[model samples]
Target: MRKSELDTPCILVDRVKLLDNIRRYQGYADAAGIALRPHAKTHKTPEIARLQVEAGAVGVTVAKLGEAEAMADGGIRDIVVAYPIVGSAKLARLIALARRAKITVACDGIDAAASLSEAALQSGLVIDVWVEVDPGYGRAGVLPGADLDRLASALVPLQGIRVCGALVFAGHSYGAETDAEREAIARNEAGTALLAAEALRGFGFPIESVSAGSTPVGRFASAMAGVTEIRPGTYVFGDVMMVKAAALAIEQCALTVLVTVVSRPAADRAVIDAGTKVFTMDGEDSAIGTGRGYVVGHPAIEVAWFNEEHGILKLPDGERGLRVGDRLEIVPAHCCAVVNMLDELHVLDGDRVGATWRIAARGKVK
Candidate 1:
């Protein structure tokens, strides 16, 4: 089967480009003397996760216990849940998972660590955990310098939880304008994380892994001497934001939504089958760019507006040649959410359908 034969509003991944991305990042991590643990939240497919492991990723990072279970069921032995697991239900599941694989979790506070430790002790298992250090994201982690020390100290001698090291998400470096700025941001974050790790060690805690990195920051994070692993997710499927950020070229984008022109309202306007439901309404807040997704192969065609099922395109004055039934590939503004919207992804290699991978853990938020 070919991509042209697939139904509209479907997710399509370019096999060759995806492999290139995986290999490129893996090579960078290998050369930098760091472990590559690509996040599974982006692709959420065991096949792709296995590809990363085969390409030299030490393991895969999952955001939830359900994702970890899916990967484990798919034969992935090493897993890391980068989010904090709090509730008893989820903690029990996490401990059970630890019995099967080398599973790890992240903690940024005392209560969460105590819960995890209690769960592990009840299950007769020891769970390795990373102390999350805030790297200016202000999302989940504890403040790096002193706050991190406090949390690490609180976890000491916990029955079944071992403080392995630190974890920082360099999300602030994503939209940086230049490579120098991005590198500087990653270096600063990595330095702070390393300092916190040393502080934990000084307090008699064993710090084994100092992890940091995102797709945009991976380029610079790989060069940071203290970072032991890079956890990049979007590199497996470059999106419009990555392209605009100059982190990836247009050809390197592995994921796109296949949409058909369903309405030609005017000479200079057309509507595509995909909209907020398929491409997602994210990454469009910048003052410097147009709205939502960008039409692939049509540089001048801008997705001016979108509803739940229809995307309005504003074609250039002389470029209004699109007709109903004509298909156009759209690179989503954010690929992660788009992947979650679908149940499966069509893998393609230069227009020829290669394979179909089930998105086994699309909406497993628990």
Candidate 2:
């Protein structure tokens, strides 16, 4: 098959570019002497996860138990659910997943840890856990200090829980305006997590791994001292936000939403069949650029807004090059959200269809 045969408003992944992304990040981690365990939440495709593993990813990181279940079912041997698992329903799945994969869960609070410990004990299996440390992002994870030690204390006494180490998500790096700023965020993330891990170790907890990752701060963050693993998901398919953040060149973007022009409403505006549903509204602060999404190679065009199924492309003054039936390639603001929105990615190697890989963990919000 070919690109022309695919339907509009679908994801197109350039296989060459995809493979390039995998190898590039893997090579970086190898050189940095850290394990590369890509976050599977970014792609959600087990096939792509296999490719990542083949490229030397030590394991896969997921944000939920459903995703871990899917990856483990797909034969990926190791995974880490990077989010706190709460409630009996989710814990049941988490414990089940632990039987199939080398599972590790992250949590910053003792309450969640208690639930996990109970579940692990009920399942009669030992569970490894990482004390999530907030690297000043203030989203999840305990701050690096006494708070982390408190959580570590709660887990250390649990018969079923093993304190592995610490994990930090350098999400704030996305807000950085320059490479130097990103590197600084990465360095801070590593240092912050290390401080908590060392503190935990002081209490006699075995701190075997110090995990960290963010696409914008990929190599810079992983190269930080004491970081044992790097989990990067967006690097599998670079997005417009990454390009705007100077994380990758526009040419390196492998995933794009292929949409067709449906209306040329006026000289200054046009409409495309894809909308927010196709290209989600996720942004990385300034990394989203000036438009809802960047029209690839069309700097003069801006997807100014999107309805449920209509994308309004605002054209530059006196520039109406697009016609009603023409197709456009859209670089989304967030590649991970785009993957979740689609059922399968139309794999392509420059205009020719390679194969379609189903998003194995789509809608696995649990």
lDDT of 1 by residue, 166-214 (tens): 8988687876888888888878888878887898888787889998888
Query: Cα lDDT for residue 351, model 2?
Result: 81
Q: What is the C-alpha RMSD of each candidate to the true structure, in Å?
A: 1.5, 1.6
Cα shift from native, residue 286, model 2 (Å): 7.4
Superposed Cα RMSD, model 2: 1.6
Candidate 2: residue pairs that collide: none
True lDDT of residue 305, candidate 1: 83
Q: Rate the local accuracy (lDDT) of all candidates.
A: 0.85, 0.84
**Candidate 1 residue pairs in backbone clash:** none
Worst 10 residues of 1 by lDDT: 284-293
lDDT of 1: 0.85
